[model samples]
Target chain A: MLIKIKWILFVTVFFMMGISEQADPLPSWNNTNTKRNIINYVENAVNEKSPYYIPEEDRIATFDNDGTLVPEKPLIQILFSIEKVKEMAESDKSLLEKQPFKAIVTGDNEYLKTANEDEVISLTLKTLTNISERQLREEVKDFVFKTTYPHLNKTIDKIVYKPQIELIKYLQKNKFKVYICSGGTVDFMRGMSKELYGIDSENVIGSSNKYSYNEATGEMILEPELNSYNDGREKAANIALIIGKAPVISVGNVGAGGDIYMLRYSQNGNKNYKTLQVLINHDDDKREFKYGEKNNISLNWADKYKWNVVSMKNDWKEIF
Target chain B: MLIKIKWILFVTVFFMMGISEQADPLPSWNNTNTKRNIINYVENAVNEKSPYYIPEEDRIATFDNDGTLVPEKPLIQILFSIEKVKEMAESDKSLLEKQPFKAIVTGDNEYLKTANEDEVISLTLKTLTNISERQLREEVKDFVFKTTYPHLNKTIDKIVYKPQIELIKYLQKNKFKVYICSGGTVDFMRGMSKELYGIDSENVIGSSNKYSYNEATGEMILEPELNSYNDGREKAANIALIIGKAPVISVGNVGAGGDIYMLRYSQNGNKNYKTLQVLINHDDDKREFKYGEKNNISLNWADKYKWNVVSMKNDWKEIF
Candidate 1:
């Protein structure tokens, strides 16, 4: 009887201990080698006893916003600018006669579709300028809240990757200061970054337009001049300028060519800094559309640099 | 006896409570109206029941670095630039033939003194350009630690106003995020901001030179182009771009006319924001040299705007 009681007690204690010890940090991630590697790296970096431990103040993580955090096939800013132009054309019919404005407002999807990425960006900027900073923010808020992602059949806020969201939380919980280093305008992302990813507006570093304070009107107005194009090597430069530190972790999707420099910069940080470069490969055709052969640059760079590639089909258990 | 014991206990508890409640937040400040008002404003700002209560995240405070934080008799950047130019002249003798380099290296202080502020600034830029970002930082660090204030006979780090330091601590304890918004270069200020003000490098926003990445050397080099001059209205613009919000409190010393726009911007923030503009009057000739009639712009603005004035002679118990 004594032996039977002791055996039952031992089994109960061990089971509870096992449950306590196996807490999932990244629940949305699958039980794969990639997930295990991420968990192991985080554990070592956060462990005080480990030689790879980074102090909390120095634990900076930067993520590319559009493709990495949310779906960008129909880019957020492009949609936002188109809607804004349409709204403005309602009041002033003559604006539709302009070059970029006409392209966006005339239901002339062909003009925008046939144009290169730079032309599309120019069209967006033309639509966004000539407004007070306050008005721009209000317009973006309205669009972000009301619009839906066509393919996903969900709201823009609901379209963020479940695994990436989990990763952000995991990094934040480990005392890392997470920043959104994006190619979009700072004012555009400032509207919904906090709502979508728990990122503060100040931590969102991005491209900017020339903004001047009007002494007569006491208003901050946005001008058409492009102050910065925060892409390619400029992303790293802006990170150094704004954040004033080398990030320990850089996360981005593979489709864009911009995030390569940022990732390489992170890898080449201080020798004592143990860095991680996570490139998300959109390979799950059934879930998220696969960009096959479109990410050759990122793939080649990853192969050369030995960067960790997170396959959407294999690593992520679910994609929103 | 029981009644007597109860009365003694009540008196003892009340005495201890009095001591705790009366602890001065700014001990380095004198018992003047300015000191009293500062305490009262902070108390109300932090009080949850008060209409002026600001949330911790929104409690941002910006301070000018030059005259406000450290003495800027010979502007901190000018002194730093001169020393850097002198050091560079040692390696490259050809640099001595340059306009600013000749003036600084030959100790022709008259050129800097006689020249207008803008001309002096132009000279400084000429001397500071064309160096790697790493080299600039290394040079700034060497100069900051070794240099001393001529008048005060103390190292630059030791010359920061004691009362201002106390005020910073008081504001920080009340959960205000302090930032140094200076007219100096971002790279130069980033070197010692952490040591001097307990401010992180990220929180130090300042003027910047255009920078480019060298692919071959893997270096970020400073180009000769002026990226942004963070002074006057430009200060407010940079604050909006970098900080992404208006500061609740703006503190600057009355010597130069640069801080006027920043103070006005803080005051013109959200209607319900409850902002405070503090202008430190350099009126103490005994402890610190008096800038008598030179700060007319700031003085006039403060008078018209009803900004709080911290009189150095009457308000502060110590200067350095």
Candidate 2:
């Protein structure tokens, strides 16, 4: 009888362990304090009977795309824009004579960098505005798929952090609403977000240009009108405008200008909403590149706001 | 005994009627089908035991500011931009000689209209980028406070729809995460979003520009770099990037490009999240100006996507 009872107990324990493993919040993440804390927060908030239970409506989460999700060592979008200028210059003989286009085609990063942001914006507008919205969509889609990140030697989509991707899914599983707010063009995000992050195009909000339907051509054309810049405080405003409510939980990496704004938005304690503002401090050097404390905006914000800083070096058991 | 029983019955009936009145959603709104449906849907979704009960995380909502929330009759932002340009042109004589600035100072709407979107964008960037971010923020804040809508003869904030404001507060009360996602600039939105909509700056997402901090000047500066246009697919991408999840319910007027994208983003159902897309179609000539049809991108999107179209003429009991 004792032997039989022991066998049953062992089987029951084994099954429970299997179930717990399956339910691990950060499966891709190595066992680390950062991952553990994140998981614990979600677990506490998601528990229906827990005092910290956040209603599903308030479970809004935000992330920065560029350096946080994918490798930003070579500046992906800028590189793409440069390559586009090169390609366009080859075909359009007039482009070679144009000042900015000529500079870009000649592989002049210094000149391009010195060129005022307005000039770069103007050039981008000129390059992109001539096409129909449909065409632009297709073009961006093709570019994302075809272009590979120079450092990673992989497509931009493929270069996304594996662990972060799992975190997004895990958040969703726990009834958290996740969003990607970037400074990239909304169209480009629409093309890539679904495949890469399982986020729909509409759920992605970013910087934008003016658009109008051409009556003569009967095509939806994107105009090169400078409308709005979704950065810093604007990033916060965009979140409020587009999301319609303040998020209880906001997550972002350093250098994201809008992180402070997000923290402020979440900190407004009204009703049952509890705000958790977390900043991912990239400090790892071996498995992943790290930079902050010098020119990093998020670090400055974290220090100023006293936000929950998750160091990659201290927080993670593994880096992906 | 009979007289006492009669008194008790009357009191009970009066108490029940009062409770019913309080329970009615948007009682000031006309008994329109759209209004009724919206109220019913929200009611059903809020009940914990209901199958349609949306968890707080998925109960994300979005709103458009211009026509939907505030009176956009004179196009407030455009007028402010024009006035700023005029002031700058007058103060700096050189601006008067510049093409777009000169045209703006002269009140040459015809010239302004004649210039392509690129030219307008270039002009806007040039005028705005020359100042520090702090200066720009203050300038915009003062402009919003001082400026009045011409026809209404009221402050822009006062011109916001009372009913819509109530709706925002109501959503907040119910724990729905709300955000304002506009086609307007992030800086512009930040200046007024909190005051007007009770949405904090961080929750607002809109169009943006590339900004950097100048250590030498000890100030944050905005560059007129055209980074991305946050419209259509871009709006959706921004939502995904910033919010990090699909919104279950999205609200907007016909002019909101982000709204259309939000609907699309939520509808793909890639992650098994349910979405409700509501379009505030302006058909009421008496209360609000009406525009858009098959030609309008947003309207076309609604029809193509089969979204819940709430006509102002038939949907609401009241305009404000």
What DockQ would candidate 1 receive versus the native complex? Answer: 0.51
Q: After superposing the true interface residues, what Cα RMSD does each candidate give?
A: 1.6, 9.4
| lDDT, candidate 2, A1-320, per-residue tens | 99999999999999999998766756666666667667778888988888888877668888767666765555555666687788787788888888777877888867643443234445567676666544655666677778877545777666777777888888888878788877666665666777878875556777666655333343445577754565666666556555645577777777435456656556552235556777777677665666754566667767776677777676655545
Question: Top DockQ: which candidate number?
Answer: 1
Predicted complexes: DockQ each: 0.51, 0.07
In candidate 2, which residue ranges exceed 4 Å CA deviation? A1-320, B1-21, B109-123, B132-134, B215-219, B255-259, B269-273, B293-297
lDDT of each: 0.80, 0.66
Top candidate by lDDT: 1
Provide the global lDDT of candidate 2 against the true structure: 0.66
